[model samples]
Target: MTETTAPAVGHQHDGPHGYASDKGAYLKRMRRIEGQVRGIARMIDEDVYCIDILTQVSAVTKALQAVSIGLVEDHLGHCVVDAARASEAEGAAKVKEAADAIGRLVRS
Candidate 1:
């Protein structure tokens, strides 16, 4: 799998992001996921059964996927729509970027 990195310094978005309105909720969900991950580590450390560990892993994966899908929808609704209103070229660019992101998600 490809490894993604943070945006380059000083290259951050100029305006509020697509998920800006729901940022708090997103962070909450992420924290929950983090806890789940820590739980998984504890399970391994405690010699939990293989199946049970796998089950927890699957749950964590699904939670992450849900977050991803929500972000995608937000991007399409807010960023893509706003770009479309700004200009055809900008809209097309954002669409392509979003498509690439979706492709990565699907492959994952």
Candidate 2:
């Protein structure tokens, strides 16, 4: 059997799936990272030093990792915990999903 997932719609301003309270903070950090990306592109265009560009790239990677960690923590603390309270099977499924997500992040 094949299972399909539908893309989430109209959630930009509704906050993250897990972290509803810190939506503004997350958005601000993401915007800052977006600017950093633009700056890195400009640096490349202007023939900036390779090391400098690599350093910026590393910073962006770290920032994204931080965001990922935060989201995962929120998911486990809220979603997974809630599911655990509701049912053992559901809780196990949520835990497995969280583990898979963490594995992907680690591989990346």
Which residue pairs clash in candidate 1? none
Give lDDT tens digits, candidate 1, residues 1-108.
332553422323446778999999999999999999999999999999999999999999999999999999998998789878978977888888899999999999
For TM-score, the strongest prediction is 1
**Candidate 2 least-lDDT 10 residues:** 6-15
- Cα RMSD of all models vs. native, in order, equals 6.3, 6.0
Model 2 residue 105 lDDT score: 100
Question: How far does residue 65 in candidate 2 sit from its true spot (Å)?
Answer: 0.3
lDDT at position 41, candidate 2: 100
Regions more than 4 Å wrong, model 2:
1-16
TM-score for each of the candidates? 0.88, 0.84
Task: Tell me how candidate 1 scores on lDDT.
Answer: 0.88
Candidate 2 lDDT, 1-107, residue by residue in tens: 33245222322112236788788899999999999999999999999999999999999999999999999998888778876897897678778888999999999
